[model samples]
Target chain A: MKHLLSINDLGADGINEVCRLADLFTEVSQRPIPKVPALRGKTVAMLFYEDSTRTRLSFEVAARRLSADVMGFSVSSSSVNKGESVRDTVNTISAMGPDALVVRHRSAGVPHQVTGWTSAGVINAGDGWHEHPTQALLDCYTIRDRLGSVAGRRIVILGDIKHSRVARSCVMAFTSLGAKVTLVAPPTLLPPAVDSWPVDVSFSLDAVLSDCDVVYGLRVQHERQAEALLPSLREYTAQWGLTVDRAARLPVGALVMHPGPVNRGVEIAPEVLDQPNATLNEQVRHGVAVRMAVLYLLLAADPDLHPEGEAS
Target chain B: MSTVIKGGLVIDQTGERTADVVVDDGRIVAVGTDLSGDEILDASGCVVAPGFVDLHAHLRQPGAEEAETIETGSWAAIRGGFSAVVAMPNTNPPIDCAAVVQEVLALGAKAPCDVYTSGAITVERKGAQLAPMAEMAELGVRLFTDDGNGVQEAGLMRRAMEYAAGLGVILAQHCEVDSLAAGGHMHEGEWSSRLGIPGVPAEAEELMVMRDIALSRFTGAPVHFQHLSTRGSIAMVRAARQAGVAVTAEAATHHFTLTDEDCASYDPVFKVNPPLRPADDRDAVREGLADGAVDAIATDHAPHTMDAKERPFDQAPPGMLGLETALALALTELNLPVAEVVGLLSWRPAAIAGLKGVHGGPIVPDAPANLCVFDPQETWTVDPHDTASRSRNNPYAERTVRGRVRHTIVGGQTVLVDQVMRP
Candidate 1:
């Protein structure tokens, strides 16, 4: 567990191990004094080249909870805008002797590139259209919390599978955990070679609604409409959105999940988030704990120190 | 001053022979037994052949000197056994006008290797207005292209082809439809899907190749395809040539040697414009070279600084150091005869760049003394730091490659001896 760059890096066992460790962190997150000395004296740096709110804040909370010092480099305020290359920024930050770097960039492989530039462990907060491993781990934890186990569950990831890092990560994480993932999107919104993925594909949300154990709604980026990936968000919503009607079609206790900063009445109806089975809030809550587990695993806990740490 | 290249099996357009070639006044004066001259260049255990001619090279001179200058790129070319290299016009102030073309030629005048340049098909390569091809052609610019960007509008390309046909110059296209290739950082395939990078579909290249073939037929002008990577594009070119559409194609060394799978490491060094494709496409390119469908093997040797390549995959500029590695890669990766590989790298590309009688050799009396001496079986690993080009974005760095240049002669000058460039 040198870095959590991709969900694919974590196999079925690694996924389960993360979920289990996240369970321990979730318990600690509930305690009145949640701070732990597990990562004390260690430092974690945030290099978010892209604008991120939830992911950055979640990681900050998680690092603080584990008692690790946190340093941040926002692109807008930093030397990045002064024409400093990603390599220079990473090298400069790495010189400060951080144990791990949490990187988010608008390019798919920036985190992977950062790994080469720095000796520190790397956690991909989110890279462009690529995997958001922590988000996926947290999603796995949220699902396991609700359904008790991910195995044998039917998970339908809906909308914008082409550009959503969340959907890419979730599909890998859920499918790795033995949950069958069905990706539902307009043919244009789906990735060009999604057929190679270990998942079923559907065009209509209505068709797959009754069969799913979990409906993972991906945010339909409105900018894609301008790119002509979709005709309009209204059309995307009418076709693939987890609307009030579509949510009603799910069998009793079927979960609705969305990685946050959701556009209301776009990928989902306004009332859908209010549903009891909706796990958007839970996904956010689990994001912090999952990140705490990841930071602990990368920065604090030694593999030999863990009771049954499988060689990754 | 006369020089004798001794103990080499000379392979040229006229075929192979064990000959001691004597050069004086920039022309071969003798090709016979025990030739004596003022200077001796030992070519023992070497295949002395016509020096390779690269139809595509980005010397990055006139601008972007931080990446490559004419002197450095030409020296790299000499090291790679290329006596001549055509500079692509994608520099900062692109080689579009007569003055720019003249400036590039003058700058390359003192280079160890011959540096010819391609004039831009459009002004500044913006693809909107036609460049002064005739004026640039008068300065010996033989090939014209908007290399980094394909001329997108069909009508504009048709007009450019008509103009090039009249000017008696060939228009080489980079063969990408910008609308189709928009925002794509690599080849669109299962690998790209897995990597989550936006993809440029093979159709983006094929569509333009298809369009140019039609335009060539319509205008009755010859169109040359640059760095044809996709299998479909090769098939189209093969068919169009069979149909006598006057289309010639060249494959870059990397297209046949590396694939899109190389981009999995997320190292931007592997990121190229026509982006490395799948093994199937790479094999197709190889087959195209083996057959007569592909005419030449050019080093689309674009150079970029380390800082530029250090950016993320999508943000990093696409190119790799190629002038230093083309011949070795062709010899190591392609399962073709040495002569055929030489033809692909030398005579064939020389013909495409309109350097027929001047460069590609017959190794007889009065032929230009441009020759390369190489041990085809010698192996050397590529080291980016050891190269003469001002960039280190070599994807083949650390890759063991066969066929090293032993000696290179340009215009009767021994520019490289015993694998070292003359100071």
Candidate 2:
């Protein structure tokens, strides 16, 4: 794929290929040196237009581990703060010849727009309520590592599916991997056209919790709550929050995941983060390896660099 | 100086006839079998009709001249077989009062097409207080609208309707409830869910359409619905018409020709206000047009600069250039007879825009000679870069469409002849 902007951009076979490549990177991550010379001379730029701590740090670590040079564009200090247009900013950074441009913008399709302006392999880190392909990939990697496979798995993505790019991408990735995905959120938290999605949707989280092989909690965007999308944080936590009782109801050995800077007691119980089944920390770790796979596949998969022949 | 448009089947509200039209001193002096003038413009095997009139278009003048000025928009309108267009009241400073209306009218005086200005229904389109309807109406502004946004307050909209009724002016609405349509970039449907773009539910538009229909009934004033994009909105309009409500509606060319699925590419060009809807909604728009439930195919010709349009689909302003492609798209996409198509583009919209005597015509003598000659069978691909407007946001670029405007005569002056603008 020219760009990892959406999970839908990768079909079942393409997703499987990415997972297989990520397996090799996962092995590299466990090594004593934990470094690879695959992307030795390449450079990757991380353009974060939105405030991000985990995603930004994970991508920077991934690039460095691959021995690739990294350039980070901070929205606060860059020309973006001076009202520079996305095109102007992309062009300015593109002139430096970064092989892959990992962009995270508050707008849905900024990564797609960047693709048109630059030759750099564009990666959608996390755009506004749109797909975050790398997050989905890491989630898939975590799921496969624990459960052996995602196919036929009952995956329930819970919480604010409407505002969660993670939910959108995970639904797409999981469904492509043959998982039967169910989206659980309040009617308002679900997108208006959720019925048309590949996954079935449910509002009652407790009813589906026991049947799920994976209970993925999406962050309830508190910013949207000010618009009265929700009644209040208390009501939301009461209804959709993955509390201790809900976590205990999950099928034995079923994984519980969250794409964090978790709201603690809002989308998930504060105690749930410390649970043995909670893969939130593992998701962050897998994020590095999966992103390393993506960068290597996109930037350094030339025939000369791939001495063992291509992954395909 | 005079021009003769010869050897074409002249079709107008009065019907079709083989005629040669002669124009002089900004009026059609003769239209008969063998009329002749000092200049002859060939129109063989073409449908010669009154130039089209758009009830809604954003000329973006006074403040947003970077996207479109009256001169450039007029050229685009003429190239699309339009002799007149009602410039929407949603410009930068907005045409909310007599001064802005007068300024737009003055700019239109030098344009190729007759540019009529619509005043805002609410002051500055804020939906709080009524604009100076009397002053604007006195300046010959027949239509008032808070277009780009609907006047959200029911009381204010009612007051504006009553005031407009008293002034003998029509109020047009852009029909979207802000609360429901907020943060939405495309119609809420299958594509929107899959693409994960925030969706504007059809009900957001339907609720306002329902409100306006009731408002029209209560106030006994005519309301023109702009760019009705949903099945529910069209069905409501159809039912309202059946109930004898004094409401007229126009659908944009994109509403009937495109759908929300086009937003799959996440291209902001397909992103428009009332956003492209589902397939059923698209079909309903077409059905509304063919069955006369809809009055005119108005081009909501909104022009945004390339830089503005290049933003991500959600952040980008909603609009697309339509003045240069509306007629061709109508001809290519709608399954209607050429005569009915001409009526939608010509007399029907001309009447709606209150440009009857000056624009849409019977093509008879002394009719001011606003006419268009087009080959209905001819086909051409749209190139956005070839547009006359200052912006390049045409969604129909690379689309091969049948029918083309060959010549346009506005006020007896040959503005466009053989697809070339007259200097």
Please name the candidate that would achieve the greatest TM-score relative to the true structure: 1
Q: What is the TM-score of chain A in candidate 1?
A: 0.96
The DockQ-derived docking category for candidate 2 is medium
Model 2 alpha-carbon miss at residue A100, Å: 0.7
Q: What digit string (tens of lDDT, one per residue) describes model 1 on residues B76-195?
A: 999989999999999879999998888899999989999899999999999999998999988898999999999999999999999999989999999998888998999999999989
What local lDDT does model 2 show for residue A265?
92
Q: State the TM-score of the second chain for every model.
A: 0.99, 0.99
Candidate 2: lDDT over CA atoms? 0.89
Tens digits of per-residue lDDT for model 1 on A1-312?
A: 788899887777778777788889989999999988999998999999888899999999999999999998888899988998888998999999999999998889889988888999999999998889999998889889999999899999888889888888888888888889998888998998888899999988888899989998888777998998888887788777778888888999999988878889998898989999999988889999999888877887574223564552
Provide interface RMSD per model, one decimal.
Answer: 0.7, 1.4
RMSD of each: 1.6, 2.1
Residue A39, model 1: Cα distance from true site in angstroms: 1.1
